[model samples]
Target: MANDTKIFHESWYRIANEKLCLRSSVKVHRQLFRGARWYVLSDPFNNQFYRLRPEAYEFVIRLGLDRTVEEVWMEMISAAPESAPGQEEVINLLVQLYQSNLLHYEMPPDSAKLFDRYKNKKQRIMKSNLLNIMFFRIPLFDPDSFLKNILPLIRLIMNPLGAILWLTVVGSAIKIVIDRFAEVSVQTQGIINPSNLFLLYIAMLLVKTFHEFGHAFAVRRFGGEVHIIGVMFLLFSPVPYMDATAAWAFRNKWQRILVGAAGMITEIFVAALAVFVWANTSGGLLHSLAYNMMFVASLSTVVFNINPLLRYDGYYMLSDWLDIPNLHTKATQQLTHLVEKYAFGYKRSTSQAYSLKEAFWLAIFGVLSGIYKLIVFASIIFFIADRFLLAGIIMALICCITWIIVPLVKLIKYLSSSPKLERIRLRAITVVSILLLFVVGFFYYFPFPNSFRASGVLKASEYFVVNSKVSGYVKKIEIEPGSQVSAGQPLIILENKEIDLQINEAMASLQESYAMRQLALAERPEDLATVEARIQAIQTRLDRLQHDREELVVKAEISGVWVVGNVADYLGMWIRRGAPIGQIINESAYYFASVIPEVHTSRIFDNEVKRASVKLVGQADTEVPVFRYVKIPMEQTILPSAALGWKAGGDVPIDPNDAQGVHSTEPFYEVRAYLDNNNGMKMFHGRTGKIRFELTSEPLLRQWWRSFRQLVQKRYHY
Candidate 1:
């Protein structure tokens, strides 16, 4: 019982003399919650249902057109005062039943009051839906008759045999997805691409159509009516929806859970079929459509329908499985109760939780769900804003008004005027004011540690790029990779059969010229000169050929680690002259080449940076200090290493046209910082890492504003 409730209501006198009874059209059903039986009064005409406790149900059943409210109340109190509801409870129950059209009254004035309450209830529902513009819905027609028509087919599929088939298909699809996981993952990158938007939306509509029918058919199969079928504009995108609340009247909790999970089950089955279609097809409209269908089903089921944090199918299933009806509403009430009872020191505040375990769960779920909702909403706003700025702005304004501004106004009104807080009103106001001030101070006034990270690769300050000096096939690798070698050490050996043959031929020609010259000297002095010239020319060609043969042996020019890669794999491979073989890195000196984005360069360049450090991807825990640094003032689109670009698994965006992945889509400033590698770790050349620059402390509010401004300037060019 609430603290606000009394033994009797002052206005009970006006209803005490009135005679009322249960409407003949109202049907009662029984269900169990927390092992206790609860009765549900279903008004078929309005498709509305209300739950009643055993005591309240007894009082309601005893009332009739011939019996007055006072008579039933007096008998109930006299018979069982401990279990019986008080007069105040009775009055409230009567008013609720009357508003639900479950109560029949003989008086015209009472009927008029009930009609006004019903109209007000409708208005409140409309206002509430309007406030939730992101998930707005429009009812089209009744689905009960249509579901009834398909009852036989629904029964055929929603059974044991159907479950087996669903499992087999879904299992096969799961296997296919796992086998081709890489391809599927790559395809997901283009799911939201402008070219696929039309097909994606079409796929979503088709999948959602079946999904809503799944719920309707499940309800109808279990002897329940689905009255409303409509379109819900989820994130301003139209999707099919259905009313399955009639499942709440089922006596079996598992039945209710089944009704809730039916949609997801149907969607997964459809997605499984889509997987087969997508996997088998090559490339066409059908293939794209199948892929899109799979994308829509999996994304929606995982992100929304199956997530218990949102008020979707999974949430209802969780509630039914836990035997906790109105879990979300009760959680909010539990939080409010805690605030009133503990925070404001209210003695009369009642808890919504029935046990300590329930209270703990309620509190945890309340906090998490609230936080998740905010994150989801903010993410959606930003996601839409990236594409449609105007639509995003409108959604953001609606969310701010509904979630923040209106709630704050209501909280202030409650703290000032709530009757339950009459004695502790001043304390409540003070506590709330302090909380608000603290929150504001934390965001706008308090200093926080400020730092930014840029992606780049480590580079050796001194390194020699070993290149092949001769065009020949590799015969042998003289030194292994990472071996210490002398300056004149042979790194690799190459062979040129053509050069060897030429040298042999040149030597033979020179010997022949020498013999001819000897003969010419005895015959004619002029001929002897010509023979001598020929011998010299032949000798010169032989020397050049021998020199070319000597050049076939590739030797290290500098002493350092021999950084040849896959040394054994180079055997018999043809190498062109001047091609880079590997880098001979001098590990004594190393530096980080950090790619600072254009937006962050201005902040770090003009601000006083406290310190800078390097965190290599290979050694994430070790932070190497920067001994010295230099910033290149010019804007450059080319990255120092391809590993720093998105194409190579880095955060930096790469230009789609750059196949080498060394060119960034935007220009960035490269900061070279000599790292102190004295920390007993070797830094390799071209190793990827992040450079962290600790800057001056700033408030979170200011940081957020600056980020927002940068985003606008970058996206809109203003």
Candidate 2:
């Protein structure tokens, strides 16, 4: 609840004696936000807006051109003592109104002071522009006349019927996109290529142009004026922007929300149209352009425009929908209020939230948005630095100054000068100092449990891949798959009638040749050489046939479990030379074959790894201990199993051209960790799981710094 009890600031004594009132041109409008009645004070001449609670509004309404601030306060106190604004609140309200140029003093304002105030306002705007350099905007022209000229033609489509038609078209486009998902996915990869960059930029320009116009048209449709149209450097890329501040005065929340959402809706509609054009057209300049338009439209809308974390169209829309005005600013204030009230024990500090629920939401949004901004800015800085080092470094310095240095300086100024801490300055300083030290100590000195995980598949350490040694028919199945087998154990029996007949024929011929050789030796010495040559050839053929007859049975090469796929299907089936039979795996000797990212190799190799374990994907609770590990020196693009790649529903990205999905897009080192099989966990070949390596205990700050450096080195090659 607002503090209605009277609390006067020392400066209020002088201000209370002076008579002040709002300018005649200033208008006051009633509004209800979050179930509480409020007033919006608007200065038409300056186009400025200020929101005030009902109590504050009541106090303001009582002030007149001839009435003194002290008189108004006394009358408000008599009329509603419990709901009246306190003296301090009244003084703050007057200061805000005066600063916004909505107030007129009884005496003529000094020209020099007025000029100084104007200069200060300009300086503030310049400072804000400098801080937000990444999203800076420069107004170039008035677009109201242009919007007025186009309004008549577009008025008919800015209604419910038009909305229905848009939905129908967009729905159909969504279906087409889903149907040709693969084609669209492949096209996305080419959007960033140098050959298509100009086309992509053109597409982006057109889409953003349409988006800005969408907001303008929506505002115009709802009797709002759009005075300024300009270019904004969004992430250092120039794009169209428009001022739609007129929508802020709209009585209906839905109207305000529609104005905010208009840009995204327009972008989506354009993307839907582009989808149709891209789908129907054959490969050409037009087709490529249409596809690029679709890509940019969808990407920019989702990534920047519609995302609520960033201060964009969606953020405004969310604020309006939730009945929260100036959400970002208020949330920030709420956080500051929390630190002041709770941490510093400042009694006068107050939250911008109207209720506890609002305070909770504000805190949540503040933290999330703060973190998101850091991530976004960091990414942009690194991205620019990778392209242009000197420019990027300058930008980084500016960002650090604006985001870090400026905020810290302001905080120190507040701590040193703010009157709210007059009584507890020493206490606040001591508490804040201790808190800061505690945080630093926790991050720098405390040891934390740290581990890195990688996906892998289980395999037998020693396994023999069985293949057919001779061509024949699979006559009989001597052993089943997964059954225990010994070395030289018969797994399959093969028979070939042709081989048997050939062996018999060779033996008969050999016998005949032997007889002829003997007869030649006894009767004719000259013919003995020819008979001996024939006998040698026949004996050689007989020996080969006898050897083939002995190799009719397929046997296990080593003693272990017999592993064969579709062994029964091979029974009575014709077998070919060098065909795969299966493997005889030593089940007891199982290991996990994992691929570790090149960046993480330092953590595995440089650090002393304390422990390692493997967890099967579906069996989250079961952890298989690893007894030994070996890292392959060679980096390979091929993964150990398809199960560990994207195409097979795994996390790792694979080359799109690799139909088998076993080829990784980036090279990774393969590491084999022997798993202890004594835990009674069923081990299977090709079973996918995650392997975690626990490294030596270290402070989290050091680990985070190392990981960040590794990422920078890997990505920027620094």
Candidate 3:
């Protein structure tokens, strides 16, 4: 017998004399886990599978109508004494097999217990479905027959040649996207537009359909059956899914891994095909639909499927690669094991991990997955609530109940009533109570660094808008755009033939008037006053014409960077009077103009700002110090710069009605933080960045409550 095996269990006498055998309908398959042989008991009727180690499998096979369970156990111990399972292990094995309907009892009345077990299993499944309301599934039909019919075709594509083709197509599609990256990026901003929602849903459906089919084909190609094809309501949106778990029975771990990754591979291929369609077509329903398909495929595969932290395709692949079956469940159990064994000081508590290395991985994965799940859940809730408040509220409530309330209730029950904690119950209770209190107190009392960030653009403290004083055509650009120029330097020269001609005519008239004035003075002293008046009028007109002609040359109003749009495009283009040609900013003086959400305005207004800093995009290391700030109390929808809107790749939500994208959808308070001039930082006008306001330290719970209150007030006006 193995040294680690328990000699006997107290409950062994109850099932010692019972005769049981493996059900005829349940098929057994051999597989390897972590280089150890394991037998998989597959129940064909229910499509359920269970794994059993060699020692347990031998004992199970020994069971028959004539032999008692104790006799079978004795035989198992005699055959493989070193690796035989203990009596407690035997009891657990039998209970699990009976619950799974993989065992049949000789006594007919014992069948009632089996029936009850099956009913309980069904009820548990129903409860699980209810808890996972956001991801509920409804089985539609069996796809085994359909998969068999398409097996040959699947084999043809699930090969090396198909892989080569996939690479070629996907590579070309990537190149196409890279070539027009800017246009594609701009188009992506409207992906969730109300007008395009229907098309987006359709594209998502198509991509997911192909993705499921890919799994089905892979399973069939690897000699596995895919029976259940269903619609999974992912966040209340129906998407097709298939049962590809039969691949778990495959002996080759690589085959199982391949099956897990097939869905994502298929999605990428679909995205590539959609990219081609989008690139080839112009503006139309087809082009838009293709773009949506590309978006859906890439988003689903990357953010959801390929993320190893989530229990999706990538997670399963990682599990198979690491030879960890039921990784999530085991990792969760490992966490519990740590709490009970170490935290509660329960020495008898068993670990779910097989080795120290595995325990470390399980611990790390468990913590990371839990955190990621919370982030994803919160993000989903916010996203849904932003669109549908009532639906989001309902989902949040249900998820809180299932994820938080239920687990807490279970933990309390375990601490109070579990038999294993009988000896250390008091200590365990005290430890858990302290932990709970610590967590609550920490959140409610501990002061954390409080700050809020807003997207802003750099602006000059004082700037001059260079405007044409007189209407004229631009003849030359004396100073290039983006060049530094001194004040009064000629920036552009304008030509106006009409103004020049007027000046010449006025001069000629003045000369003629002077000659007439002199002649009048000599011939008739009475006509001298009229001639003098005529000469004065002509001289005034000539002076005005000369001034207008001189105004044709535009000069810089300030000594700063000459910022203008395409100087070459403006050459020969007629500019009207008072039209803005360019802006000459005082580069030495700068300020950051940031828009604060109306809800968050109270934080800045009520509290004295401790400090503020600006971090420009692509220059994260440089912190520009803010000396003074000016807050515009009035809420306005106008953005200081278009770069702070969605259309310009900024984080602010823009108003669709405003074509220029400089208008925001919601009203915000504009805050201008004057930057330090002596910081040796060259700030550019309209350069977008984030400005963080350091406020008084506040507790996280208080901050959260304040945010929630503000959210309700802003969203519901309550």
Error of 1 at 337 (Å): 1.9
Per-residue lDDT over 231-325 for candidate 3, one digit per residue giving the tens place of the 0 to 100 score: 99999999999998888788899999999989988999999999999999999999999999989988888788989899999999999899888
Expressed as tens digits, the lDDT of each residue in 554-671 for candidate 1 is 8888888889778767899999989988878777788899999988987789988889999999799999998888988989999999998888999899987889999899989989
| Deviation of model 3 at 143, angstroms | 2.7
- Residue-pair clashes per candidate: 0, 0, 0
**CA-lDDT, candidates in order:** 0.87, 0.85, 0.88
RMSD of each: 3.8, 3.7, 4.7
What pairs collide in candidate 3?
A: none
The model with the greater lDDT, 1 or 3, is 3
**Weakest 10 consecutive residues, lDDT, candidate 3?**
108-117
Q: State the lDDT at 25 in candidate 3.
A: 90
lDDT ranking from best to worst? Answer: 3, 1, 2
Candidate 2: Cα lDDT at 510 = 83
Q: Against the hidden reference, what TM-scores do the models get?
A: 0.89, 0.89, 0.84
lDDT tens readout by residue for model 2, 633-669: 8889999889999989888899988998999998899
Stretches of candidate 3 exceeding 4 Å from the true structure: 1-7, 75-81, 107-119, 179-190, 193-195, 275-289, 457-499, 509-541, 552-592, 614-627, 637-665, 674-689, 711-718
lDDT (Cα, 0-100) at 309 in candidate 3: 93
